[model samples]
Target: MKRLLAMGCGLLVLGWANGMAAAPSPDTASVDKAIVHLAPTKGNKVQGTVRFETVKGGVKVTADLTGLTPGKHGFHVHEKGDCSAPDGSSAGGHFNPTGQAHGGPDATARHEGDLGNLVADASGAAHYERVDQQLTLQGPNSILGRSVVVHAKADDFKTQPSGASGDRVALGKIEPEK
Candidate 1:
């Protein structure tokens, strides 16, 4: 048995040397979990990670963030995954594939990316966990290539287009976890 396993491994290595590679892993569309590594846009010090796991009705979002003021900060997945430009403007607007107006996560008429707020404590650390029924990980409305933006202020949840969330402080593109 061990000899056979060794031969298989050797064959794989030999294949690699001959310009052949193993089959590709499942792409983002078929993945059940994803992670985003947040980085400050420019001069900000905010940093964090956000994770998404598919659940029964929707997806579970888990976020751990730091370097925020001791208050509420807007948090939402943006339409585009581009975080290249300073101030995070390259990410585009809030993800509203359904054409709904800005609202809270629990609102029925909210945009698909309206995830509400992240409250940081006095130490500037915030840990948020929520199961979002509107956010998805598969099919036409998949958020696989989107970006999550943390704003400088709280989401009013009643504004048009995007909640009155202030300037984007940190951003990270969602990608399938390796």
Candidate 2:
């Protein structure tokens, strides 16, 4: 059985050397989807799920959240995956791999994790959707394992490092979809 397995492996490598298309390596294989389940931090009751799906030229981000104020709130992918802190400070700063000034998602230059805002309706529910070209599901720059944070206030979009968003009311880690 061992010899047969060796021969099969050898044959597969030989076929690839002969110009047969090889299967994509796991490291480079495309990830079709990712997800995050947000839980309220501290005393907040906000909870929701955010889905990321690959689309042409970018990833489509969709989020549905409840238990929020009836207005815009700051939202972003934070640097650290840890959400242990009661105030959500364990997640650290924004996921600014490219080292950019804080800006709206549509800005010419912004943090890779800067996802702008999520507006809650009068009923304390918010639904958001957008195509983010800067986000990646694979590669070193991928947002996987990082954390998403929902702040208590709107992102002013002109702050220095992080928008003047208030407390982190909710947090979740980005993970590959099952």
Candidate 3:
């Protein structure tokens, strides 16, 4: 009888251990769509809103920005969600969880945050829309909690690390869309 009781207790402990080791599945519904409302950095008037929605191929990025210099500007998703710094440095480097070298969105080897550039019109307003294949709202490569940064100059895709993008002009934290 003692042996039987010990066996039963062992089974119960094993089951409890298994339950404790399991992790809950990610909430896919909460990440179906996300948005970032951008605010201008110090001495800059750049402002924008970037929307990310799960589409057929990947996440569709739609950005509408104003007060830009009428040319190309670097746009990327940084690793951190904080945009508290006056120069937008609060949001750290590009979101490159895979440790890949910097390259354009089309490059076979590129950082997850290498989003290329946003072109501004003569009126200092820019509207950009593209479907990014590398970005995701869920899973390990998720961009859900990251931040979007708009640079003052263009992203010269060939440059190393960060494409030599100039000072951050605008920043916003990516969040789930209500």
Put down candidate 2 lDDT per residue, 1-178, tens digits, no spaces: 9999999999999976743222112342467788999999989999999999889989999999999999999999988888899999999899987788999999979998899999999999999999999988777577777889999999999987888989999999988888
Could you give candidate 1's per-residue lDDT for residues 1-178 as a string of tens digits? 9999999999998977643211122244568898999999898989999999999878999999999988999999988888999989999999887788889999998888999999999999999999999887776577878899999999999878788889999999998877
Report the Cα lDDT for candidate 2. Answer: 0.88
- Which residue window of length 10 is worst by lDDT in model 3? 20-29
Best by lDDT: 3
Ranking by TM-score: 3, 1, 2
Clash totals for all candidate models: 0, 0, 0
lDDT of each: 0.88, 0.88, 0.89
What does the lDDT read for residue 29 in candidate 3?
A: 43
Model 3 residue runs over 4 Å out of place are: 1-29
**What does candidate 3's lDDT look like per residue over 1-178, in tens digits?**
9999999999999997754332122454457899999999999999989999999999999999999999999999998888899999999999888799999989878999999999999999999899998888876568877899999999999888899989999999988899
Lowest summed lDDT across 10 adjacent residues in model 1 is found at: 18-27
| Model 3 clashing-pair count | 0
Q: Following a full C-alpha superposition, what root-mean-square deviation does model 2 have from the true structure?
A: 9.3
